[model samples]
Target: MSTLTDRLIYIVGPLKLQNALMASFLERETGAKCLAVEKFHDIQNMDNENTGQPKLALWDCLGNDMESCLSEFEPDFKEVLNHSAVAFFNVSPDLGIEAEFIARGVQGFFYEHDRIERFPQGICAIFNGELWFSRKIMNEAMKKDKKQTGLQTRYETDLSHREIEILAMIAGGASNKMIAEKLYISPHTVKTHLYNIFKKINVTNRLQAALWAAKNLS
Candidate 1:
């Protein structure tokens, strides 16, 4: 397994002091260079000394209003995911939102209630190509898989070839306009297909439909 020294780690948060403090701690713990980034976009600005080094971002999701924080964070998600293996820190311990983040391609999570000592090991684990979800979440996911095995097959079978193609594009973070252009179809036609895809898969939005495609299509 590769050590964290082979990559760069960014501690991203709204608060500069917090980001810096976390970055310092990680540097000491992992013997790897860590950077403090107040904004996710800031990661793009900094030039990487080693272009081949893997990048990991520990995003601080701690706030009284998590909904607002998350909503604000979503827009930059695709961009950041393209450049880094992103993980959430200072998250609520409930594990209720783990599935949503997983669908959005987050690499791992560290709850606020988690012991500080555990952070290094968890971060190391993530760098070792392991996901850092709670055991409870893993068990729940396993249960869901078993229960939905037949339903997933049905959903897969019900999708048209074009719809399947569109779903795959959606999972790849393509917008409706992009998909339409690539497929040589109108945006309105794309919307119609999306509506049908959502209905057939029992999802209400593009995110859910994308997640469904990720699990069921491939």
Candidate 2:
């Protein structure tokens, strides 16, 4: 897991704008091969193949397609996902989402915007299996909308303000239960709200829903 040499960092997500700038920055900086797939379905399908999972797989929790890829498969990547070192990044990930992912198995979690300048360095550090956020000072970042675009803009003309709010929270890494609690509404309302967000975002699951926002929101 010494990431000093050229190695693959399996990338997934909408590969949205927030991190793309940083991803490119890292690619140029690290001399690494960042392999990406539109969805993790390809890897899931090739689960039995001998491609050998990378020494490090950098994933975004916001991909709904990956969620489906996970749900639909039995020998889920979760089994082999951590056989090697794993580092996770979230564009607007909050505690709840980060906790969920940690439960699923991740050594670290980072926010895209905050780490923009540090991604290149961070990935190498994380690849070594260190639980990285910071040695001191754990962090999180949330910005009010100033017309920033990730996957959210894809729905700008289609979604309502309430739906937009729910999407923001979801993208920021809130669960349906947490979203309901935060929005002061019933879980049923949260589901309804999320359903609308999903439709507008054109994704089937929350991860994808979040990824949509991550890629387009800003």
Residues 1-218, candidate 2, lDDT per residue (tens digit)? 23445466656556567446645666777767665544444445444543554455666655434454345322445654634445566645433444334334454556745546556666775553234543221112222222232223343547887887887776665556677888799988887877777776676555445545655654
Give candidate 2 regions above 4 Å deviation.
1-3, 16-23, 44-54, 62-75, 80-84, 93-95, 134-218
The TM-score obtained by model 1 is: 0.62
lDDT values, one for every candidate: 0.73, 0.54
- TM-scores of the models, in the order given: 0.62, 0.45
Clashes of each: 0, 14
User: Which one wins on TM-score?
Assistant: 1
Q: Candidate 1 at residue 56, lDDT?
A: 84
- Could you give candidate 1's per-residue lDDT for residues 9-77 as a string of tens digits? 988877888778778888878877898877787777773544667778888877635476567578777
Candidate 1 global Cα RMSD: 11.9
Q: Give me the runs in candidate 1 sitting further than 4 Å from their true place.
A: 1-3, 47-50, 64-66, 139-150, 154-218
